[model samples]
Target: MAENSLEKDYLEEDTQHGRYLTFSLEEEVFGIEIKYVTEIIGMQSITKVPEVPPHIKGIINLRGKIIPVIDVRLQFGKEPVDYNDRTCIIVIDIDAVSVGLIVDNVEEVLNIDDEAISPPPSNKTGFENRFMKGIGKAGGKVQLLLDCERLLKSDEMEIVEELFEEK
Candidate 1:
């Protein structure tokens, strides 16, 4: 549960302020800006697609929308674990395209002040650091703030798009 703090304490920028939907990945808390979150759905049957990365769990037809789901654990390079009742997808709009993020469990939406967020560590040499928008501190808890736009890069986005298009 002790996730590494991304950066040193810096001046809080007001632009980061807003409601964030926090979720659990194991014990670590992660937050995605609520502006991009569409809704939360229980883990349903996901039709696996061929030739995509393992992290890309494949697509789901929610009512009618075909949204690709990515295992956040796998995306973070963590060991794969079994999905339980608490497991669900946080459907978010990344640059307008809807995608589902499979999280260990969904917590609640939190109103994180800009002052509570710290910049991502400049010293990190890992890929995960690239996706971090900042580290959020609220209610004495730390939440890894994710940059939704960067969650899936242009090329990765293209890959996800093609997964279902090929069908």
Candidate 2:
């Protein structure tokens, strides 16, 4: 089935992972595999769209391309904070679709090997850690690895596509 092939490809991609682009959401640090990252852009003006999810802050026009912007903090059910100079949009490619994840600030990209990562705790239920790929350890610090595939559901992606089509 097509799903099987997609899963296989994702697994292979996981094997090729090494570097992670680290960023912050509040005081906690998080990292996403560098392979999926396209570019890092500073905070930009967003066109607000109605009836979208709370986390979907709206869409941005990035050099003529319209892409939905997700507030990582709000997506995690955290309190909304004012966007400041340090706020950034981490443009990432997932399944050939580009989505911008608005993060607090970006830290340096680090080479976090597979051995330095561990699975998230399984005892919990609900959305907490739902998008976590792993917990990474480096230099006495921890970074929650984000699974981009899990971060945005297909239905939500559909909503985004519809918005663009209407524009």
Candidate 3:
């Protein structure tokens, strides 16, 4: 009776919020909400935008659309690595702008329970912590869930504008 109804409600909630797309940066796992993801493409040639920040790898033409690409490794303050077969570009849309994130490789979509997500550790050191929304635990490993909107805010893009203004 009441017990059965409660179980059904829990299952429904779980189904609604139980999916994430996991990817790797360096040796750590990270995830972004799947809903924002547009597509994943293999590495491609990028045209450098002069005077832009180093993290901004450059722009890529996708089906007649030019999208800026960011090397997540550089964004995270790691030494840049050469693009290899496993490298990929993950297209995502934030605030109506489509951008591509260059990642080492994408793992797979995971169903992580909402209850398993914990707030970012207060003591974490480095710039990486500022980009993390929370930490999700699954299969005994931690996935640093990113706050995409914060990570891709206009403040950082202002640097790009400044570069163009100087030219």
Model 2 per-residue lDDT tens digits across residues 36-154: 99999999999989999999989999999988999989888899999999999999988877899999999978888789999987855554677899999986799999898888888
Q: How do the residues 35-65 of candidate 3 rate in per-residue lDDT, one tens digit apiece?
A: 7789999998999987777899888999987
The whole-model C-alpha lDDT of candidate 2 against the native structure comes to 0.89
lDDT of all predictions: 0.88, 0.89, 0.83
The candidate, 1 or 3, that scores higher on TM-score is 1
lDDT by residue (tens digit), candidate 1, 63-130: 98899999999999999999999998999987668899999999988998888999998855554587
- List runs of model 1 lying over 4 Å from the truth: 1-17, 124-127, 164-167
Please identify which of the two predictions, 1 or 2, would achieve the higher lDDT against the true structure: 2
Q: Show the colliding residue pairs in model 1.
A: 6-121
Model 1 lDDT, residue 79, Cα: 97
| Residue 52 CA displacement from its true place in model 3, Å | 1.0
